[model samples]
Target: MLVLGIDTSCDDTSVSVYDAKENRVLSNIVSSQYSFHREFGGVVPEIAARKHAENIDLVFEEALEVAGVGVKDLNLISVTNRPGLLPALLVGLTFGKGLAYSLSVPFKAVHHIEAHIFSPFIGSEPEYPFIALVVSGGHTLIVLVEGFGSYSLLGKTLDDAVGEAYDKVAKLLGLGYPGGPVIDRLYREYDGKYLELPKPKVKGFNYSFSGIKTAVRRLVEKGYPAEQVAASFQETAVSYLIGKLKKALKETGVRRVAVSGGVSANSLLRERLKELDVDLYLPPLEYTSDNGAMVAYVGYRRFLIEGEDTLEVGALARCPIS
Candidate 1:
């Protein structure tokens, strides 16, 4: 079946078409709002919603055109409806519902994080009962995945997420908006031996990055070079992630591991994962961030079982995976 997926969960307006039978994505289009929100240092919910409204139709047209399929050919429509900005989620949800209603097709609502967890399966499938580490701007969690729609959240961030920490640190160092990519690039330019950032000692599977972020502030105030600070920060942050993931692997005894979300695209993270001595699944860089393909794939899976959602289904600001 051909499924159309829309994601307006955050600062990206995305649309994609997936072919369930072929296990292939026909088209995936993402219009980033980074340039729009850069001046503000972070996403402005209202502006993100408006951008989605303006681009959703054009994105839809692009997706259909790229897929070489018309609206009537779509068997189902799916959209991210929860765990994101309320207004942004509504833009995609409303558009998806309208399309489904007009096309007389089944409509499904997908969780944004769930889509992240399923990202690794976009191009290749993995065996069941694998560990999923979802690290992104808004969320960080280690989940135990038993099967489709079956997830056990093992640990999550107690405060700010890793990506948020990156952005905050970048801002404190006078770096530009969307800190992850910038810091990741700059950190490689210089070895970070000048600064020693604190790694959070928080116990259990849960994570805490607020302390690390503060450490960056203090070190920067001490007149450390921004490049060295960025490098030190990235190393410490990624180390925390690796430590937590190792703990999860030890506890769960799951040999197969998959990582998703924007931060999963980090070179350091991928390099560390490769040395873990297990079957590792990492999504291509395109699927690492917020994109319509991940949502479309997850939606296609759900549509095969539960089918359509009622018209009453609405958007939500915060929805957790149980």
Candidate 2:
């Protein structure tokens, strides 16, 4: 089956064509709006939505062209319709619906986080009854995955997501937008000693990054070196994430774990995960961010199990995976 996936969950306009029969992604095209949101130091919802509207069509065409497929050849159209910026989600959802209607194919509404959960298993089947740690710009949560279409929300952020905390800290340290990569780079390049940041004491598997972010701000206000502050913050944040994952692994007794979302691409986090004595799955860098490949792959899997969604389904700004 040929499935076309569209995802405009945040600042990226991504489109992909997945060949289910071959279990491979034919094409995955992403157009990032980093340049537009850079000066603002973060994503502006209105600007992201506008850019998605302007870019989605061209991205869709390019995806199909690269995949060597035609609209008529696509058997299903999958789109991210929930748990994202409302305006941005609507742009992709509306366009996907139109294409599905024109081509007379099934329309599938995919959950953004759920797509991230299975991103690493795109070309291969995922082992069931594992743990999923999803960390990203807009979300931070852990889940117990029993099987396809079966998920138990383990815990999530009570405040800012980890990636958001990174961005906020970077802005405080005079770094540019899309903070993760730059901060990661600084953490490696700077030999400056890091400040002692407090670890948030959130109960259970839940996370709280707002406290860490505020602590970093105070250190910056105290005139600490920017590189030291960046290094300190990154170390603390990534350690916190790993600490929680360890807790979850021990408590749940799940031996297999998969980490997804943009933050999963962190070098420190990846290095730490390798130290654990359990099976680990991480998506290639391309699938780490908000992209259509994972969305399309999950859509195809969900469609096989739950069939298609009604055309009347609407976009949602906040939706739970449970």
Tell me the lDDT of candidate 1.
Answer: 0.91
lDDT of 2 by residue, 1-322 (tens): 9999999989999999999999999999999999999999999999999999999999999999999988889999999999999999999999999999998999999999999999989999998899999999988998999988889998899999999998888899889989999999998998867789998898899999999998998998899888899999989998999899899999999999999999999998999999999999999999999999999999998898999999999999999989
lDDT of 1 by residue, 50-126 (tens): 99999999999999999999888999898999899999999999999998999888899999999999998896676
Once superposed on the true structure, which residue ranges of model 2 sit more than 4 Å away at CA? none
* Residue 251 miss distance in model 1 (angstroms): 1.3
Per-candidate TM-scores read 0.98, 0.98
Q: Rate the local accuracy (lDDT) of all candidates.
A: 0.91, 0.93
Backbone clash total for model 2 is 0
Write down the TM-score for model 2.
Answer: 0.98
Question: For residue 275, what is the lDDT in candidate 2?
Answer: 97
